[model samples]
Target: MSQTGYQSFEELIVWKKARELKNELFQLGKAFPPEEKYRLTDQLIRSSRSINAQIAEGHGKRTNKDKIKYCTQARGSISETINHLIDAFDCGYISTEQLKRYRIRFDELEKILSGYIKYLRSLPGD
Candidate 1:
């Protein structure tokens, strides 16, 4: 139905992985200090969610070019999320181990997203 042959972005492995990471980050945000409720926690949750949101939005686009654009935005969200994670670490909200674990997961997601973008670029014109 879509350019990728998938029925929905939800069916994409990259999107699924992004969703998993978003959920994990959401849980992690819950433990943040109440004082940070409007700051770091909010930013972390929003950026993590953006990755999947962009993917889903891109999947609905009619052109491969549009899809690639959205995926690129999702990649940007990934970077923003990692930066927030680093801030959490600096603030002592998360341990170095937790930060490293998230970094690895995000790295994998970035690679997968890059692959998806490459595949899109290989497709014929819109």
Candidate 2:
């Protein structure tokens, strides 16, 4: 919890954005018909949230390599989420507007994650 020597990337910007995406995901899934509760709904929410959780886990690892690995996993989770979101749009589980919104956020995060990974890879003693 100490701020000493902590990286700026650990600030609330990324976490806040990810948290907002997770909330929107929850709302969108909740709007789905009850029949989907244990199916697409659950899957979508789980995958969406995993992206955020994995990033934080990676940060907590404190090793550049380990952090990069978790960020890679998070990127994979985001890809899976994008597919699910597309499916949700196709199935009318979500609006095209909602999909667009989530897509934009996901894309932004992807770029950030990619940059972080590249930066990590470029570090000495990796």
Candidate 3:
């Protein structure tokens, strides 16, 4: 659907993907061992969710610079999420299939976000 009157990043494709990634990460956390419930699992889930949260917050800003700043933060959160996912995989908390799914989703989100960033840069402001 057209995002024409949608003033926030919550209505954007990348944000939706990030939100879905957060949900999946939460579900993935549930499969982890009980000992990790409050440790790596929690951290991973939080980081995943934060990415979209930052994007929404950024979109609320009136200026493109501020929006890009928040978008950068969101991207950083994505990196953190990817790192945590790698840690989970190395620790054997998730299977290869699960890792593949996360990577694929992250990649798509990254592309959308990157495109948005480029668009913002092309705006009148530096």
Candidate 4:
């Protein structure tokens, strides 16, 4: 792919951060007991991974509105990941410090995703 201007969704900073978030989420879920393997752990993994998958889908869309719709899904997935992380902390599966660090990462991803959505909305002809 050409590097003229973020030729692919993988070139996006938000996607990269979201990917990192997914990895951290996997590590976090791995620490949970076997009982959670198919419950909280699975939700955490799926939601975190959804953030990037939706963003990539959005980037391939042909219209600003379509992109906005999919990015909105990405944003929702980010929120879902945050909620699951909070549950993890509340259930004592992860440390408070770990939750804080993960929160910071997701917060940054949220801000960037929000800004990107705004930019897409502001595009000519919508």
RMSD of each: 2.2, 2.2, 2.0, 1.5
The per-model lDDT (C-alpha) reads 0.96, 0.83, 0.87, 0.92
Better of 2 and 4 by TM-score: 4
Instruction: For candidate 2, write residues 1-126 as lDDT tens digits.
Output: 356867644473555577778788898888898998998889889988888888888888867899888889988998998998998899987788988988988999788778878887898864
Best by TM-score: 1
Candidate 1: tens digits of C-alpha lDDT, residues 24-123: 8899999999999999999999999999999999999999999999999999999999999999999999999999999999999999999999999999
Candidate 4 lDDT (Cα, 0 to 1): 0.92
User: Whose lDDT is higher: candidate 3's or candidate 4's?
Assistant: 4
| lDDT score at residue 10, model 2, on the 0-100 scale | 44
Error of 1 at 102 (Å): 0.5
Candidate 1 lowest-lDDT run of ten: 1-10
Task: State, as a TM-score between 0 and 1, how close model 3 is to the true structure.
Answer: 0.90
Q: Write the per-residue lDDT of candidate 3 for residues 1-126, one digit (tens) a residue.
A: 456755456668888888888998889899899999999999998899889888888888889999999999998998999999999999998889988888888988988898998888899973
Question: In model 4, what lDDT does residue 122 have?
Answer: 87
Candidate closest to the true structure, highest lDDT: 1
State residue 94's C-alpha deviation in candidate 4, in Å.
0.7
Q: Using Cα atoms with residue i matched to residue i, what is each candidate's TM-score against the true structure?
A: 0.95, 0.86, 0.90, 0.94
